[model samples]
Structures are given as structure tokens and as C-alpha cells.
Target: MEQLLDYINQHSSSGISEKDFETVKSYFTHKKLRKKQYFLQEGDICRHFGFILKGSMRQYTVDDKGAEHVIQLAIENWWVGDRESYTMSTPSVYNIEAWEDTELLMISRQDVLELFQRCPAFIETVKMMDDRNNIANQRRITSSISASADKRYTDFINCYPNLLERFPQHIIASYLGITKDTLSRIKRQLLQKE
Candidate 1:
């Protein structure tokens, strides 16, 4: 919770007040998940928004062919949840699973609406997050449509240098929308160039 407060302080026009923070903090509940445990499964209504205080998770979807496609990785200080599902009270089409033992601060959709009503600083935080998410989504769409496999791989490496060391090659390949073999080939070709 302190981390979240600090994040808001750093990003907001004026930091949140003690009274506002107190009100905002009450709406959140702490929870922990073990590795491989799911926070949300496909077809479940996403009721809560999660703020990762520690560890990592992946939001993904499995297709009819049973191939998993990663949508995003949520690390420390990141938010994870199906915004569409939460907003609409519809079933989620994605699953959010822990990659490591994770701690989260979560709030129900109702509480979120209340928080927004009471805390103006919280609205700034959400706006900043939304701007970042939009830019990322646009980059990903452009990368998928216009970039070559090798270029995509290079961009991924440059953008998330640490993820290569943290996640398995297969997971990274899946996130990059490439086969494991293709990832290996790209790595080998890059090595040859070096």
C-alpha cells in the first residue's frame, strides 16, 4: 500500500492528502497467490482490480486449438485485471495466472467506483496508467502488423531486456507471437551477426 501511495505521489499533480489516502486505502484488500495459481479464469466475471505489490503474473488466453497467447505480463508496481469485464460485469475471455508467489492489493468494482468518486488523485493515477496502456497497445499492434520476426525479437529485447533472463524462451516466443523454433533461429542469427 505504501508503494501505491508513493507511485501516486510521484505521478499526481499534487500528492494525495492524508484524509484522501485513508479513504482510498480502506477500499483495498490484500491477497496473495502462489505460483501457477489463477487470479481469474476464462468465463469468470472479473470483480476486482489488482495492484501487484510483489512478484509477476501473466494475462493470457487459450485458443480453440489450445495454444496459449500471452496478452501482458504484470510485474511489481503494475496493475492486472480485465478492465472490460470489470466495467461491463461480463465474463472475462482471459486468464490471469501467477508466475511467482505474488502479493496484491485488490478492490472490487463497486469500491473502485466509490474511490473514483471520493479521490481525485486516484483519477489522475488511472489516467496516467491508461495513457501508458494505450501507447503500449498501439506499439504492439504496429509491431505485429509491420515488423519482421527478427525486428520484433529485437524490439522485445530492447524494450524488456530483463524479461529474457526472467521468463523462459517459449513464454517469450509466445508473447512475441512466434514459435519457439523461430525464436531460436532469431537468436542464432543474431549470434552469427555478433
Candidate 2:
């Protein structure tokens, strides 16, 4: 709970007051997920939004051919959930799975709404997060269409160096819209240049 308070203090612009922090803490439930376990499955309503305290998770979609497409990855101190589902109580199109054994501080949608009502400052933080996510998705789409695979890999590495360390090569390749073989070759070329 102290860690969560500290996290809110550091990341949230308006910050959380001690009293408000306690209220926020009271709303959260601790949860654990083993590697490959899902926090939310496709077609289910994402009732909870999770803040990662430990380990990592990936939100992905599987095609009819069963190919996984990585959408987002959340590590410690990051938020994870299907925003549309959590906000609207609709079915989720993505699956959120633990990439490693994970611990999360989770709060239900109702609790989040109540918190926002009580702590108006939290609304600013959520809006900021939404804006950042929108920009990131737009950048990703633009990069996919306009950049070379090598450039995409380089940009991805530059943007998320730590994520490369936490996630598998195949997952990274998928996120960059490249095949594992292509990623391997790019790595070799990069190593040779280095």
C-alpha cells in the first residue's frame, strides 16, 4: 500500500493526498498471476484495471489462425486493462496475460468511478494517460506504414529498451511487425555495426 501511494505520488501530476491515498488503497485488491495466466480473456468484460507491482503482462489479440499480436506490455508501475471494456462494461477484444509471475493492485470499475468522484485530481491523471496512449498508438501506426523494418526495430529499441529485456524476442518481433528471422538478422546487423 505504501508502494502504491509512492507510485501515485511520483506518476500523478496532481498527486494524491494522504487521506485520498488511504481511500485509494482501501479500494484495491491484491492479485497474483502465474506465468501465462490471464488477467482478462477476450470476450469477457474487463471489470478491473490493474496496477503492476511486480513482473510483467502483455495485452494481445489472437487471430483466427491463432497468431498472437502484441498490443501493449505493462511492467512494474504501469497500468493494464482494456480501457473500452473497463470504462463501458463491454466485452474485451484483447487478452491480458502475465509474462511472468505477477502481483497487481487491482480496483473494480465501480471503485475507480467512486475514487474519481472523490478525488477529482485523479481524473486529470487518467486523462493524461489516455492522451499518451492515443499518441503512442498513432506513432505505432505511422511507423508501421512509413518506416522500414530495421528503422522500426531501432525506434522500438530506443523507445522501450527495458521492455526488450523483459519481453521475449518473438513478442518484440510481433510488436514491431516483423518475423523472428527478420528480427534475428536485424540484431546480427546491428551487432556487426556496433
Candidate 3:
């Protein structure tokens, strides 16, 4: 996809050469999923790493009490997969599901390894994503363990403003580790402040 090429070029130290771009493109396959379809399910091995060409997806886990906890949400231009499972070839504990009819550029684990060796731009993009993901996870962990609910909600809004209208209130609340009622109160308080 052109979008994938642009994304890789943008992330690269020097934009990818046309020769490398063709190699990069060849490694990926286009995939489409309908709303409510799963890209990955718990206990399933993650076989492909996907980049969203259009639409959104959510990665979450369900507890014994049958409560879903949102771990991550991805939209256009975002990458979605169970990294640990993809890397180690283990079963994923989370489910990655499409939130809308979605189109993605997917590469198999074996192909990714081959691409990494062949395309420097693709390698750079993967490295950049890994760094960003680590930083985001660190901040999220700190916030969850120490920050107040309202403060966490505020940070979330600031970090992902566009997601407010994309996901349901309950999903947002779940992601923030807050109750629906608490999220409502927080939203009201925020509006009042504004």
C-alpha cells in the first residue's frame, strides 16, 4: 500500500529507496476484516503483524468475572498485534478485534524477519514503533498505579483526543481503569472546567 510505503519512508533515517520499497511491499499482504471480526483471539498464536490502512481495532482481555479490560486501541496509521506472541510464537492472552470494517497491510512473522534483513526503512519503522510502545506502556503503568482517576482520564484525552468519538464510553472507561459512573462524573467535571 502507498500508505505503508509513506509510513516507512517517514520513519526512516533516510527515506527508503525505490528498490527497497518494492521489496518491502512484496512482503506484505492486504487483509480486510468486518466489524466484530477478530484479528487475534486469546490462546491463539499471532501469525501476522498488521498496519491499519483504514478503520480501528481494540486489543483486550476478559477476566474470570467476564469483564473485558481494554489494553490497547488502534486506528488508521496504527500497528496492531500481540508483539510477544508474534515475536516468540506463543499464544496471545489478548484478543485483537476490528471495531469497524477494516483494511490492513499484514506481514507474516517469517516475512517480517526477511524484510528486516532486506529493507532498512522497514527495520527503522519497527524500531521506532517498539520505542514508542515502550514509552507509552511505562507512562500508562505509572498513571494506573499512582495517578487519580480524573487525572488519568485527562491524560488519556490529551494523548488520544480523536478516540473520544470512536469508541464507546464504557470502552474508554475500561481502558482508563475507571467505572462508567466515574467516567461520566469526570467528563462533567472536565466540561465544567472548560
TM-score of each: 0.95, 0.94, 0.98
lDDT of 2: 0.89
Q: Candidate 3 regions off by >4 Å? A: none
1-194: candidate 2 lDDT, tens digit per residue: 77777766766887888788777788899999999999999999999999899999999999999999998988998899999999898999999999999999999988878888887656666676778889999999999999999999999989889998999899999888889999999999999998
Total backbone clashes of candidate 2, pairs 3 or more residues apart or in separate chains: 0
Weakest ten-residue segment in model 3 by summed lDDT: 4-13
Top candidate when judged by TM-score against the true structure: 3
Candidate order by TM-score, decreasing, is 3, 1, 2
Which regions of candidate 1 are displaced past 4 Å? Answer: none
Q: Give Cα distance to truth, residue 144, candidate 2, Å.
A: 1.6
lDDT per residue for candidate 1 within 1-194, as digits (tens), equals 89989988877898899999999899999999999999999999999989999889999999999999998887888899999999999999999999999999999989977888999999898889889899999999999999999999999999888777767888889899999999999999999999
lDDT of each: 0.92, 0.89, 0.94
